[model samples]
Target: MTKSGHDILKDRLRRAMGIDLQTVGHNSLRNAVARRMRVLGIKETRQYYELTERRAAELDELIDEVAVNETWFFRDDTPFTVLQRYSRNWLKRGRGSCLRILSVPCASGEEPYSIAIALLEAGVNGPLFKIDAIDISYRALRLARRGIYGRNSFRGRNNFFQRKYFQKTKAGYVIAKHIKHSVNFIRANILAANLPILNSRYDIIFCRNLLIYLDKDNQKVVVSILDKLLVDEGLIFTGHAEPGAFADSVFIPAPYPKAFALTRRSAVVCKPDRVSYNRQILPPSLPVQPLWFTELDTARELADTGQHEEAMECCEQYIRRHGPDKEAYFLMGMILTDMDEPRLAIRMLKKVVYLDPNLVKAIEMLALLYKGLGDDNNYRVFKQRAGRVAARNQPAGKGSE
Candidate 1:
């Protein structure tokens, strides 16, 4: 296909599905399209393009090829902890008859199932809650409804939850009956014109790691749709890379450690540092630590807000005061990446891995940077290391706001 033909194909795909083919990588998009042509016995790129426009089912198959569905049960455990507290408080207050939760693009069902298990452990029974899990990929939704997962889905330090909620099978871990029954999986696209009109409001919604894949315009559209689907004062949980996307939205970060949950903005203004919503809150006073320790969080906040220069300065101050903390370096590396300084970003990220070999994120970033730079050898090396480290001591309880 000519370059113009490829560009046409990309534009058609972006219009069909709100996903930007560019984010999936040019080579990957072309490969997926070529692979699909072979599968359908289509002769040429133009033929496939026409089929994609005419046949919705074929377009969905193409989306499945490029979709990134990497997730695990209790992937980040802190949000579940916060949900437990939220469920308990809702029960205590008799706020509503039942809690309604939504997990859009609930890849492989790990997240929604995790929420159900957490609510169960918190004494919030099935009668008191309902979880709706939706995704655009029929392939993923099929696997989710099967309620079985492999070892890769059971990563991190939450084996107890697995043991309690899943039955070990020769094939994989089959989710327990009760846990599997808790969530309803539906095939729906968030960008569909009628999505908000079709779905009822939810008390809490989990739409993590999804907006980062979308371009800015689509991100705003999805955010607005989410806002409409949420009840007033409802909470939303997003991925670490997404706080900046919501910086201008109708949400405020929930006050909890490693819980990247946000509450809908109401008429009354709420302070960021106060977890007033969580009744059983931990006091802010920590046993007297150096002022520098507190500065790390300040630097992280600055970085999260996209004040890269200010955040870098804060990290520099911390390094001068304490001489290179691993977390500080990792944060600095992330800030530099956002600043489009790949060389400085690579240096900082490498320093993070040198200081703490188990820092999986730093290694993963290094692999991506190498891949972007066409350094296939280093990319493969760091990618392997990242996977190994991730399998062993998968970090938890730390993410964006």
Candidate 2:
């Protein structure tokens, strides 16, 4: 192996998972590498690197373990909300036809399960719709098949899922057979030169939070392939770090007030409970950070896409140096919101308006926080600011786009 042991490991990772350790933050990358080693019972990075470069039959297992497949049920809340709102119209139009849904990078089935939950809740059932859940990780696929979960994995979902969809099983909770049967699970790599599914055929594709980890070249390749995988009128969803990749596509953005989605002309737009924000839309990332511009964009994106913890570290670093930019406060508020710390989000947003009085989104978000807290007086003020922003952002009498 002409490459250094570390370099060889990076190459194998790039080949299998599209992860470049040189670019991924060293701490996160090292920990992730260590995590894979733990899974494989390797004692150190050197051995792991050696194994990674060997191309032995063990490559598959190692690749699966290293892929940082972090996921959960109802992960983002908005995309599914958008889907839930749109499903009614979709069902109404199709009348009796089956709706085909696909979730690529479906990691352990949470996204597919989320789709199932949304579709079932929308009252569109039976043969009328289907979800094809696919992933590259055989290990992840195996776990998806198991359908068991820990209390912490989805701590509060027991009651809702119990009431809405699942039943007690020999292995914790299995999604009701009806729900399980609604999906066809396949262990497949989306980046394979050819995808098994027909081109341009799915109605909705939930590939959220998956593409950001890939290199830009890979990102473009995947987007082009997904454009083909998506029906002319199908919708494609990506993560907060990834909204930029879709800007030039044939897909038209149907950014609902609260959620994220892009639709073909025939696709329906849904009105969510509240149109919130998502993603940083910056280009590229680096391995380390002193809060570089790309890193700010990444943090802004992390905060934007609702991955607040990852985002907070970036914003907090910026704040430590620059002393409380309103945008930093706004980003901080977003992280707090994702953390389910609405009171904290309120405090953070308050700081945002204190720093920049004209920060409309901060005001609107503050209103939402107050509404959550049942402070109607505060709600009205922030709501008015939101309305003003909305009015100004809106075109006059449709004279312009």
Q: Give all candidates' CA lDDT scores.
A: 0.77, 0.68
lDDT of 1: 0.77
Q: Which portions of model 1 miss their true places by more than 4 Å? A: 196-199, 267-401
Lowest-lDDT window of 10 residues in candidate 1? 274-283
Q: In the order shown, what is each candidate's alpha-carbon RMSD? A: 17.3, 13.4
lDDT of 1 by residue, 1-401 (tens): 67887887677666655777677676878898889999989888888887877888888998887777878888788778667766776676576678999998798899899889989999999989999998888888989999989999988686688777888989899999988988988888888886643558887889998888888888898889988888885778889778777879888665443567777655221222322222211133234432112445546655666767866776776677568777777777777877889889899999988988887778989999888889999999999999898777744644222
Tens-digit lDDT track of model 2 for 266-325: 443432222234332212223443211222454654555666676677677666656767
> Which predicted model would earn the best TM-score?
1
What clash count does candidate 2 reach? 6
Q: Candidate 2, which ten residues in sequence have the lowest lDDT sum?
A: 282-291
Off by over 4 Å in 2: 1-3, 22-24, 27-56, 155-159, 168-171, 198-200, 264-401
Give residue 313's error in model 2 in angstroms: 27
